[model samples]
Target: MNAPMAVESARSVATRFADCRDRRIAYRELGSGEPLILCLRFRGVLDSWDPAFLDSLAKSFRVITFDYSGLGQSTGEPSYRSEALARDAIDLADALGIEKFAIAGWSLGGLAAQVVACLIPDRITHAVLIGAAPPGKVENPSEPIFLERALKPINDLEDETILFFEPASPESRAAAAASRKRIEERSADRSPAVAPEIYLKLLQDRAAEDAFPDIDGYAEFLANAGIPILVITGDHEIVFPAPNWFALNRVWKSLHLLVLPQMGHGPQHEVPEMAAEFIASFVRHRSKSQPA
Candidate 1:
């Protein structure tokens, strides 16, 4: 019953690749105990994760994160669909000899995590969705201005602040600044930047997929899957607001929600230790309640 150890910076974690199917997936593994695979947000590479957040989770569980097929150092064409990304995750876990594990997906990654749970119910123990848009039609799509600002080349700290944090809140802005510094800690041996064409395609694909009618079935799948789920969000997430997922409380059989006040899209970055401790506790409680 002791507290988990502090996680080191992402720069300190060594990068490795696993050969899965036709692609070589670039990934980093940290911590120990049960495995937890984290999926990245849109156009995000392995480096996009917050170091302090990853470090905190690594303190209790073996946290593994990777670039999708065509992103970062991974080789292959970038997939536009969440299902395709989920398949890559399964492949990576298989290559690593992991039989069962938990999954945490952020933003677009959250969509993929739901697909993973649905497709392989027996393989996943717990699921955590952070600032994630629910499956089905996106009622509150991101503003065009926000996407325009985010996709542009990173010119200054202001650029990142606008993309990930709230401009109006001083506290949110400061957290975004700290998170940016942590991401920059790894200068040498950094993963490749996402290609412009690939990034655009991902955005297009997300828009197209969001229009599909069948995407709404994901909620039904999760309700019946019997897996425990933890949904984390910032109260003021401009892109994917907290209330969207909060509405799912009526349907999701085993659901837990955490909404950090005065935060935006990246709540984990704003409250890394709190988020990590919640995940650890959720996973531990679920494990104990499951049939042995």
Candidate 2:
């Protein structure tokens, strides 16, 4: 596989907006190759991605990161449903004149990615899920403390560390600090943080009894779609443990799972270069395996 380019800070990339339906979606593009759309995690804005991770992926492919509707610089009322978010992603891709692309989604974004693969199987060439919550009802819900912290306004870097990393490890905590510094690099024209009300609404929606249903059907849909999928997670992920994704292996015909040791919920941020390498390798392998 080709090596990734020199690391560039994500904050240095120019932000652009695309008109999709009635909403304007904010996004950033880097490097150049087959387009790879990165769906944002819950309450995440375009500026939240780890720069090293973005830069690494950009070396091998066109990387596109965008904010969801009603979040960050985008203008629209945000919806809590994953299906709605998936539609917004498709709309943004359409507006950008991108007919087909690979997708990488983290946390809640992963859920939306799955829905997208099902909705537009032909358009999505590959799928990557990182620290993603599994489809259907969550047998092990997020801890009360974590949920409470996430709903509260982020007062500073400490809050972010608590929300995104494991507190027990100094290494993980250090990684969180570095990630926060990178996120704050773009001081001017930065996208606005997600509003508290929107965050609460999303949490409420996820907590609903029917938040996820018919998981088996969703799994079968992905299996039939036959899209290559890469699932990565930290072994210590508190929000959605790595084992949670193992269940999909039985149903997803083309799935590869990677669990990094001594990491937390934000594995990409914690180990950006490694995560990028895994992603690039997966795409490269897929490309080679395809029939000419």
Candidate 3:
């Protein structure tokens, strides 16, 4: 594993806003720049976001990240469909008074990112999809035996640990373990029943079955727009698996795929500095190509 990068000593800003639908969205804001980048997690609360990762991006752009309505601090009952999740992102952006912005989503958030990009292409200038797929079209971690057990009420913690980190590296394993504890702690306050229902609903809501705005064949969308895209996966990510990215590449050859060695699913938390630098570079280059 690479050494953790030291984060800049900038104070992180936090906020809460009501979406058009009246759902309360909680977010953290830091740094300043054009194309206000929106960071959304795969399947956790905004607090579960890695401060180090946010700090890394804050150096280059105004980063805004928030929790999906059903998860984290966002208020509302969870809905499993990608369209519902996508609406939350759009409404959250509108609520924040943002019209155009770059968006990067990791894991499930990546799925949401794809939906948003297609649904509101004009609003998204650039997109970064990390370890995520457009529902139904890609493999899901829920199929794994380990993942099946891990998704179980409280007992799934150990399995989640095994799937989330690189077992070969103690540091990676340790990080995953720590993250598991934090997620578990966050779950403590909510009824255990809520999480399982959310996960099941998300799994069943398959993005492919739903109508999304920007999807015209994933590869076709990228090629036609020549929009900047960064598709990355950990060399050892067992959850999403590396082969899935090949499917993505087949559609978008220009899609930059970086298979980081000795990494796992939670790259943002495991190596925030590396992720930040990569995303920062993408956001900068794309911002420069367009009229300011």
Candidate 4:
């Protein structure tokens, strides 16, 4: 595990906004170099990400984190559908005058990352998915317990551990505690959590078919995009199981996987620095095959 770089902590970064079409998107950025836009998880606000993870990632790239419209500190309507979520990232990029960049998404955000790649393949340099569900049918779908736990309006550390980390493992539980503390370190410019009424309906809408997006030819796009993708996941993730991805070993041509044992959906929380390293290394080393 590497120590977080001496760069500014995510907790203190100033939140900025860009006028993307009808709405203003809330965002915070750190580091320097390649622009890396990160999409949030389901019901995740700008403050939801572990600062340790963001701080570590800042060492290698210009990490930009943002809140989807109407969900956090941003304005306008919010939709959980993959396409709408994808527009959030793309619109923000245009608003910020960014021509090309890498995109990373966690869990549900991963769906949007893939969509962005398809929508603007010429502009996306790379795509990194952390605990994200793959496109199309999964051989191992998510368990029902996720919705049961996720529907809650507020989550305690225990709820977070069960939902994102492995409660069954003492090591994971400890990591969860530390991760939670780091997430709470941000006391300023934090976005409010999505209300239960708002998120419950969103979750319910996505309950069917393991909450995977219904994009046409999504799987085919990945097989053909030839964009460098790095999937960092945990072995014990219940919601988006690793086995589902393993079954498609022959599907992705320029894909790489990192499955950590005794971990769950949020490997970035369990091993923030290590996961960040993996992401940075993947971007630095992967040979890109741009579509001709």
Highest-scoring model, TM-score: 4
Deviation of model 2 at 9, angstroms: 4.3
Per-residue lDDT over 1-292 for candidate 1, one digit per residue giving the tens place of the 0 to 100 score = 9999865567777889999998899999998999999998877888889888898898889999999998888888788588888988899999999999998898878888888887887999999999887777666766565677767755367866766677778987898889888888887767787777777877776664552234647778787577898998887777777777767786777778888888778888877888899999999887513421
Clashes of 4: 0
Q: Rank the candidates by lDDT, best first.
A: 4, 1, 2, 3
Pitting candidate 1 against candidate 2, the one with the higher TM-score is 1
The TM-scores of all predictions, comma-separated, are 0.91, 0.90, 0.77, 0.95
What lDDT score goes with residue 163 in model 4?
89
Ranking by TM-score: 4, 1, 2, 3
Off by over 4 Å in 4: 1-6, 205-210, 290-292
User: Cα deviation of 138 in candidate 2 (Å)?
Assistant: 3.6
Question: Tens digit of lDDT per residue, candidate 3, span 1-292?
Answer: 9999765432334354566576787666677885454545444666556566677788888787776776666788666455677788888788778898887777767777777776777788788877665434454443365456545755454555565567788788787776555444433223113366676666566554632233446435554455566766777766566676676665554466778778767676677778889887876665413311
Pick by lDDT: 2 or 3, better one:
2
Measured with C-alpha atoms, the lDDT of residue 248 in candidate 1 is 77
lDDT tens digits by residue: candidate 4, 126-189: 9999888888777787878777777777788998998899889999999999999999988877
lDDT of 4 at 13: 95
Q: Residue 3 in candidate 4 has what lDDT?
A: 89
Q: For each candidate, what is the lDDT? A: 0.81, 0.81, 0.64, 0.88
Model 2 shows how many backbone clashes? 0
